[model samples]
Target: MWSEETPSLNNQQYQLLQELGRGRFGTVFRCLHRASNRLHAAKLIHKRHLTDSTDRRCLQVEPKAMTFLSPHPNILQIIDTFEDADTTTLVLELCQRRTLFDRLSDDGALPEPHAASLAKQLLEALAHCHALGLAHRDIKPDNLLFDDANNLKLSDFGSAEWFGEGVTMSGVVGTPYYVAPEVIMGREYDEKVDVWSSGVIVYTMLSGIPPFYGESVSEIFEAVLRANLRFPTTIFRTVSAPAKDLLRKMICRDPSRRISAQQALSKFIFY
Candidate 1:
């Protein structure tokens, strides 16, 4: 748990190594703790870039979400947070195996069993977050990371929200390819949106292509809103029936009908 009393560390404590990646608000770096000699990822969010309340709020939400979701095997763990006048730095556990997006880029689609294992792990992480009244609004491949042991973990909760039972959130947030239909339509959605995004991930892993695609953002939004779910013979001919069934339940157009993360974990697709 984090508190006002958490000790703040100085920049000298970490030896900056290499750039890890860039995000909406800042850049992440691979750093070495000077005293512990441990590798960690540090997210450096510049205060100057926080031009609006929304940007600042996202910065605030990530650390809080991490504090709530940590200690889970499938969620990224934040070691510490330090704020200076110019930047807010998050010290995080370094995932040596990189992100699922990188894996997909290098390996194309995964075999059914491999995809199933990754999806199951992702569901476990989502289940943990949802159980705590938190919804990870962004559930794309890029946010799914793996440690040196090839254990998958979910990261990046900047867009996450806290909602109780019977609560809903309204906003058009998320990558176009993975956004739920209800979210694209600007309807009040809940944690089910994460399920929908995960479904799209499953489809991509099996077929090596996104379920919906278009040349323009507007066209993609339209496709998300009205696209029929189909597993073409060319792609899904070899996919198991149970997997397809699970995907359908997750990616349903009606958010109310979408499978919950816990229910999804119980599906035979993971068995």
Candidate 2:
């Protein structure tokens, strides 16, 4: 529940608009600067959630990674950072094209060409992040955004981490449906996790459904561990065999055997 009254850095003025979204820690609202009429999304993080050391640490990491990612076409542009009371608001580019999830809901599975285009943009973003030693632990469809060009913009850095010197953690975090097997098993993972999730998203985009779903969380975990992915060929029969082979590599049960994001980008039939 974000409001216009939320404070800003150096006492900057803001005119609040509609709430953009709400999450476990805070709500994000669309806001505008009074002086410039610059549109932005203000993310309000409650003080309580920041009390935890992990949360605080992750909060600190956002600015660093985002600043490093500045000016990327497919990355969400963080414009300003400010604080009001106990809340920390990040002024970000206001995107209105809705999420990939919204698009999928409205259009069901996308055709192969569209999916491939989106995947190329996403891979470019991920490769950029990897170059910065950053890993976006969460890469599900819901986090994908669209800018003015209706192009893909991967947002949300709350779970992102750097695998840099003396900083990598073995902890696991991500949506079950899109997570990689290594991440679910609590093993050391790096950029590969994102590649696997992208694979799931690609599959979903083509088939309009997740490859593995189950009755409970436990079952889903098992399915992920075994990489129990099955796609009815009839629907994708027109899709190339090379594309299917790439999917097989992306969803491999073992992370070591899974396709690398760089290779996945060019290996698909469309590429």
Identify the leading candidate in terms of TM-score. 1
TM-score of 2: 0.90
- Minimum summed lDDT over a 10-residue window in model 1 is located at 1-10
64-108: candidate 2 lDDT, tens digit per residue: 778789889999999888776677778788897479999999999
* Candidate 2, poorest ten consecutive residues by summed lDDT: 1-10
lDDT, candidate 1, 170-239, per-residue tens: 8888999999888887789889999999999999998888889899988888988986888999788889
Question: TM-score of every model?
Answer: 0.93, 0.90
* lDDT at position 157, candidate 1: 92
Model 1 residue 38 lDDT score? 96
* Model 2 residue 119 CA deviation in Å: 0.8
